[model samples]
Target: MQGGLEFKTEIELLSRVHHKNLVSLMGFCFEKGEQILVYEYVSNGSLKDSLSGKSGIRLDWMRRLRVALGAASGLAYLHEFANPPIIHRDIKSNNILLDESLNAKVSDFGLSKPIVDSEGSYVITQVKGTMGYMDPEYYMTHKLTEKSDVYSFGVLMLELLTARKPIEHGKYIVREVQETMDQTKDLYNLHEFLDPAIGLGTTLKGLQKFVDLAMWCVKESGSDRPMMVEVVKEIENIMELVGVNLDANSTSISASYEETSKGNSPYPGYPYS
Candidate 1:
């Protein structure tokens, strides 16, 4: 009964909003003391399935960028448009859904909460979110912010570029991701750590830019990370540098002018506070 009530509440809370990247709540049902929220079942399942290498579906660089853009839009909407603002509280790959066309949708709101912008210090409370993706600061001090999700998103980007689990290899890969841009820090020797599944076919500059952004997002201090909107723009820029032509919809190296889709707006909110 309690679980049903929780689902009902989450359904009611998330149903009213409509955005390109959020999973739409179609309806809800109560039966036999169980509450169920019906949603548009995404065909590609969770991003975790792709990240874990168990889905047998290979996500190319272009598709990956789209996924990132979609997710950021979802997070931005919750933080900016929702009345009083909603903090996802738990942002991880398992909560991200991919549709039949491979579009991304952010889901899971049972732990979401609303709070007004405040001049007070960030909240320090019980840490919530997946172990590998949880912000270290939140884990230690319980202070939470939208940036907490940015930290996790950084992990997700590294997962996309390197095809490694966030917590795998006993924190070795995570360390490399955190220190990729710092010359003094050494972890896995990133050049040697690319996921074998990807076969080193990605463009060098493209891949490096992705790595740099990933490292920036996972900075030890939450204030140092950029917002998801900025992250999306960074990825688009990297895509252009790599010859992907995000606006052209072609993976070919040829410089083409055919427009694919409108590019995302640069992050408008405060990335640091």
Candidate 2:
């Protein structure tokens, strides 16, 4: 899978996908038994870095919501807008890249598979994806569906809110969050699990709704999970409910992150990493 046909598969899949929220493939090199893919530079770095506080980019509540919306939009495009529908077998926080403007772009399509000639039909294939992010149903049934991606994205959504890996300390984020969450209290009584950087002291508007939608996406049954398109719509509604003006916040956030990152950025400033 390293230097052979997986490279070609990635190229084919990436070439067919074009979206602002998706990492764009510029070109590739295949010569002298070498394989190289050149992608557009995303200055900010991976979402994992930021969530782990390695990027020095402090994402507030609105910023996190925007990131969720952007990533969901990209997945929706792949699932619903692409020429042939695509199921991104891997949808982890490590594969989500952030730009200087804090926009989210889905990356690493090496495991992506196209669903051909049928609507809402699944492919019987080997289940391939990161542990804890893989859909439980797909893992048992070996039937790859677009909803499988939804299950993984739901885990990523939880990671965004909690700043924890899908699996940490022998625990899964989905179950941990579900058990800890109490809708009767503020912030769903998830103070211990929610990341402090997302402004828990202050109000997080539409957070309960966001958490509900994310939990829906992570439902045990694929049939019970909402589609990526529905995820995008609900995220948009959350942003609207919070009154996050997309155009205005981009500039302000850049400035704030710049000051925070001044002479102390944890990222190496790699142009193509």
Candidate 3:
């Protein structure tokens, strides 16, 4: 999969997709038998880095809300707004990229597939996605649907709030998060259970609300998961509660992410990391 020609096809496919929350393909290089995709170079790196103690920066409550909202916006667009719905079969923390301003962007479309119509859901013959992030229903039935992405998205949200890796050594960290939740640990002390790297100031109520929503997304039954539109509304509500104003017209997702990202400041002077 790593070759100049493969990279060419990838760029060609990605050029058709234009979304504020998606990592833009700035250009590509096919030189000396080396293929490289030149992306917009997000300064903040992947959500994995921030959640795994790699990034020195600590995301505060407001920024964390923005990151979650931004990622939801990206997935919502891929699921509903694209001309043909695109399923990010590999929706994981590593696939979620960030910008200089910490804006979330969906990356790595190698496993992406386009769904032309409702009937397409019934036709998928292969089950593909990350281990723990993969939709349980899809993982068992080999069916591909937008809801599958929702399921993976739920796992990503868990990583955000709990600051834990989605899967480690073939065991989903959800088991840990659920255990902590059952133990009645204070949500604000998520740093205790979460990746110690991301500074902790998140509210328990807010974190619990998102955890509930994330659980819905990763439901064992696909039909039970909410639609992308509903997901957008709920994420917006969460953001609003945290004081991020959202524009109504931007509900299309593409417009809304752009609307939110405009004039936003990067985490102040974190050495451009």
Candidates' TM-scores? 0.78, 0.88, 0.79
Residues 137-212, candidate 2: write the lDDT tens digits.
Answer: 7887788999999989989888989999888888878877877889998889888889999998897999999899
Question: Model 2: which ten-residue window has the lowest total lDDT?
Answer: 264-273
lDDT of 3 by residue, 156-234 (tens): 8878766766665655665555545642555533455554434444343366567778767866677888876677777
**Cα lDDT tens digits for candidate 1, 55-163:** 7777776677777767766776776566666678777778888898888899988777555448432565566677777777667666778788888888777777677
Among these predicted structures, which one has the highest lDDT? 2
- Locate the minimum summed-lDDT window of 10 residues in model 1: 253-262
lDDT of 2: 0.83
Global lDDT of model 3: 0.70
Clashes of each: 2, 0, 0
* Model 2, runs deviating above 4 Å: 117-120, 246-273
User: Which 10-residue window in model 3 sums to the lowest lDDT?
Assistant: 262-271
Q: If the candidates were sorted by their lDDT against the true structure, best first, what order would they fall in?
A: 2, 3, 1
Q: After superposition, how far is residue 37 of candidate 1 from its true place, in Å?
A: 1.0
